[model samples]
Target: MNKAKNVTISVYSILLFSIALYTLATLIYSLIPNIPVNKLFAMIVAFTILYLYIQRITLERIIILLFCLFFSIYTTIISEYSSDNINDLLWIVTTVLIIGIASDQKFRSGLEQAIKRNKKWMKMIIIVIELILLMAVITPSSYGNDVGWGKDASYFVGFATHSHTLASACCLLIVLIMTVYKDKKISLMEYAYYILPIYSILFSGARTFLISVLILIMINVYMKKNSKLMRNMTLLVILSSFIFALFNSSMISKFEFTSNNVYAKNMLDSITNGRSEFWKYDLDLFFNSNFFIQLFGRGFEYIYNYNYLKVGIKIWAHNDIINNLISIGLIGTLGYVYIWFKYINNFFKRPRIDFSKVQFIIFMLFTLYIVAPMLLNGLYQYQHYIFSSVLLGQLISQRD
Candidate 1:
């Protein structure tokens, strides 16, 4: 009884500490607009290491994490690099995840209870957050959606190199929503909750994202039943895509935001330069650059800057497989693939879905979906990193 009580208290304290620390960091980031966010992250990681060592944590776990760290660093150094800094960032994130897995394991019982407490509220919270953020984005100044039609585009708010990236993110979010809530019954209010964002997605005017939505809808319907719903969704997807293309082909027809974005256009433009030339150039760069890179990998998306597009040389090597090859090489990205398949096997074929199973399934589906886009195009860099990390954190939390 004493041991259980002690363990429970320790778990509560840890959860409290985590939330407090995150809140502090978020506040600091908002306050200090000039300091790079990564610097703050580095500080947190350094603090975690010190805290764990002081707490007399087991050396065995640390050693395993160190192995992961070595592989992470090893991968980072070998792959084709657009900029040394982004490569470092990739390795840092990977290492941090390793650490998170170890740290979160200590107080698993209490944390698991707390996580399960939100079953009813989670979907509502997500919907509310999305609406608030969307209103902020679409309104910009909050005056109103006035002046001109598309100029309401914030016409100038450049997030990633491409204007269409947000639409792609919306598509990805929709996939997740469908995955989580497809047949599950909620309420009429919840059904309305999903409809609004989707309507917003249609208005976002991203052809490829629309295509992805179509694919997700078809698959979802197929899973439920190969009936009229599947046929209707397929028909709607085609018609919607066609209508979007007919009206807004010009949105991506020329595709020129890289040079104009805050993050210099050099790298983004290079990747967008198209298959024939960009792949030819990047492939030679990946394979011939180093023997080690060819053997294992450099790391995921380490190539940062060479992805630019010139005016005359409008090209694109946006395919994910080609990009992964150039950046992580064969061996590195394959681990990601292995992880996905492993999780998928457990999610569908396995008998149970207690906490860890659901998280694993979510991550696997997301990781696989991101990989799928690589063959077609490359609009995933920004969103993939964040969502993959989110899913990974959830898994680590559950395992704890």
Candidate 2:
């Protein structure tokens, strides 16, 4: 019996190492400009999971994981018929493992210990940042006239693929430093940290990214208001946003490079850049399937592979809600709501932990996710995935 238990622990320990590797690799990816980022990251995480199975699986965690697996399976089934084959249902499985690990007391202790050791590591991180900045400063290519990626109005920026993500990270980091860094009062540097991401998101110019972040900024400030400056900043953002809307057509005209081709703005006329019309047509392809599919789904095979060869539009629904409805029906929507509410309930019930600014900032990032741009479109996925994961981590870990 003891040997069996030892074997179980060993399995889980390996799995834990995988998770740790994933987290570390993710941090590096967040910092670096470009690499074989996402696919490699996923592979590393999967290997980590294999290592983690050394520990005996808790029955509670198993139940949680099963719930996710079934949920994903059901999504595949729906998409099989509806043809809205989205892989988001995989989030359930991922969430179960992430939350289960986060729930562990030892994990929480390790996090606290890391924070304590930050003085030693933080110096290295600072040096690295300074070195990176210096490289950018010295590189002759940095200031050169840019290649236009085959279009006239194309402008390149420093951010890698996930601008919204970087923006959200900056936002959260600023808030954390502002609120949680013990004994540090607000200063010019801190103020810049707070505001830079919000500015960066606006400049990112992805409609989904911009709207989602703005909405969250509004809500977060409303909840954690402490000064007239924040209140004024919020008001100015609203005014500027309204002006931006009125000048939307001009903004389109100004970006002549994107204006000429596949990326041109249609004034948000059709939600998926006319893909919704295709989806409306594709929904007919299901051919009157009954009962289970109408309720849960047909399966994953249909969503990713099916094609509307005749029409120019062949891609899937860019809207999350519509996609969920097609794949999981009303039940999936309810499940999502339950998940959100579950976190909210947990947030309210947990004893106070003084995370200060970071808490509010991270919380706001979550708000931006649902209420803002994510609601509008699905183009900015990598941002959502990471931000959402961190939010989940904070909730389950009950971190301060």
RMSD of 2: 7.6
Model 1 residue runs over 4 Å out of place are 1-67, 75-84, 87-115, 120-124, 137-188, 199-208, 215-276, 296-320, 351-368, 377-380, 383-400
Candidate 2 lDDT over residue span 1-400, tens digit each:
9885555444444433333333333334535646645446455544444244334376755655566668766555444444233434443344334534543554444444444444344334333433442443344432221433233332212233343343443333333332223234333443343343444444334445445445444434444334758566755875576457524422233234333334323643333444444455446544355766556654544444543452544444455444544555556545544554464444434567565565665565554555443345542234334433443344324443
The lDDT of each candidate is 0.44, 0.44
lDDT of 1 by residue, 96-129 (tens): 4333443344434443454454334445445643
**Model 2 segments beyond 4 Å from truth?**
1-60, 70-92, 95-152, 155-185, 194-200, 215-289, 304-314, 327-337, 348-368, 383-385, 388-400
